[model samples]
Target: MKLTLERSALLTGLSHVQSVVERRNTIPILSNVLMGADGGRLTLVATDLDIEVSESVDASVDAPGQVTAPAHTLYDIVRKLPDGAQVQLTINDDDRLDIDAGPAHFTLPLLPSGDFPKMTADGFTHDFTLPASELSRLIDKTRFAISTEETRYYLNGIYLHSKDGLLRAVATDGHRLALAEQTLPAGSDGMPGVIIPRKTIAELRKLIDGTNADVSVAVSESKIRFTTGTVVLTSKLIDGTFPDYERVIPRTNTKELVLDNKVFASAVDRVQTISAEKSRSVKLSLTDSNLALSVNNPESGQAREDLPVNYDDEALEIGFNAKYLLDVAGQIEGQDATFMLESASSPALVTDSDDDQALFVLMPLRV
Candidate 1:
């Protein structure tokens, strides 16, 4: 294959696809990106067995052929080239890929394009389009609660499903849960709940960052695909069933405490400085309109901060992991965050005062 494209265009395409290729792989072809030059565009594809990313960039095509080269190396070379430089790629008869830009030249060993694995993308049961801003809100509000424990693979991703005229995204790591909802997009009716893996969520977030275009999504029992602009990302869905998350969301918590989200997060962060490294626990002693945030660590000293909040119910004291509290607080877009509590032991429900579409639940820890 032979093609000439602007360095900036090539670098953008490479950055979109090359991230899917693992740095080290047992299969040599899996470490390389497949480049196909045809129809006045160069198509780049990279995959790591479970996920595949592809994009097409406008190029001056001199020859129609395909080849594979080290994804990261090619990206680095193009990224380091001078601004506005033209990049030329050619596959030599000796099966090497040559990259030329201005006064700089580099060659990468090639693998047969046929050896590159392409994910089977057929058999999508549902397809829909979501505005970029709404998609970002759903992901940003809940991804923090996604689990890292490998044994519970289902919790490692955000659970997406359509319910009660709303498309909801839910994520939980056993200690806390985050839920965000938006109006269900067209063509999403009767869609089965699917767990989107953490890596795919991260990559999709990068793909949609700063763009205002709508994202086209296709979902099936085993796979999901997201298309935005010229880039297409296909990933395998987590096959395990997500737990019944609705049961854990508290409905009977009557005690209400409203505090400024930023102020509360700052207080929690300060008190956590003296908390034990392992537990990182912070206690909340709530009485009427006064709230006390404290941390007692034997290895270190104790810290206590008082904040005036809107609370009129019976006094309640609860303990939570400082990091978890800050995470939930960070997601709140409003000035005030409302926390509904049933008791010191029951999970606390946190909601953003400005947004009714999102909610959070945090389990208390013994302090």
Candidate 2:
């Protein structure tokens, strides 16, 4: 293939594609990006078996053909070129892709384009469009709570589905759960709940970070695809069932405490300074109107901080992971963070004082 593309355009498209190609791969073709020049645009594609991304950039096409080259190496060459310089790419008969800018030159060995794997778009049953901002909010709010444990694969992704005109995203890692909801972007009445893998969530987030325009999504039985004008990403969904997360959320915890979120988070941060790295345990001593945050480490030291709150229930003391508590507190957007409790040993329901759309739950730790 032969084409001349703007340096910035090539860099942007390469950044999206090369990120999908892992730094190391067993299959040589999987380590390379497929580039095609046709219809006055250059198409770049990359994949790592389960997920694939493709992007097209406007170019001055002098010839029409396709070739594969090392994704990262090509990206690096273009990225280091002078700003606004046009980059010329050509595939010679010797199977080397030559890259040229104003005064710099580089060549990358090419693999046959036929060896590149392409994900099919068959069996797509659902298609929809959503605003970039709303979709990002849903991901950002729940992705933090996703599990990193490999054995429990179901918790490794954000669960997305639509019901009763509401689209919800939920994630949990056994220790804590996060749920966020928004109005359904389009028809998804019969769409099955999908457990999107952690890698796919991360890739989608990067794809949407550059544009504010509306994007389209298509879902098949075992795959999902997102597309903007120039970028397209297709990923395989996790082949597992997510647990009945609703059962994990406590619905009857009646003890309520509301405190300024900024104050609560800051106090917890101060108290956790003395916590041991392994346990990270913190105790919350609660009374009519005061909450005390404290941590003790036998090998080091102890810390305690008190904050005022609005609570008139029976006094209680609860033990929780300091990191978990702070994570939940950071998600609270209102002036006050609300906690609903059953006892010192039960899980705590966390949310904003008035908003009900997003919820967080934290499991208690034994002191």
TM values, all candidates: 0.99, 0.97
lDDT tens string, model 1, 22-64? 8989898999999999999999999988899999999999999
lDDT by residue (tens digit), candidate 2, 1-367:
7889899999999999899889989999999999999999999999999999999999999999999999988888888899999899998778898898988988889889999998887788988888888788788879989999999998899999886789899999999999999888766656788999999999999999857888788887699989987899999998899999999899999999989998999998899888988879999999989998888888888889988899989999999998888888878878988899999889999988656789999999987
lDDT of 2 at 67: 90
- Model 2 worst lDDT window (10 residues): 183-192
Model 2 earns a TM-score of: 0.97
Worst 10 residues of 1 by lDDT: 110-119
Clashing pairs in 1: none
Q: In model 2, state the lDDT of residue 215.
A: 78
Give all candidates' CA lDDT scores.
0.95, 0.90
Residue 167 error for model 1, in Å?
Answer: 0.3
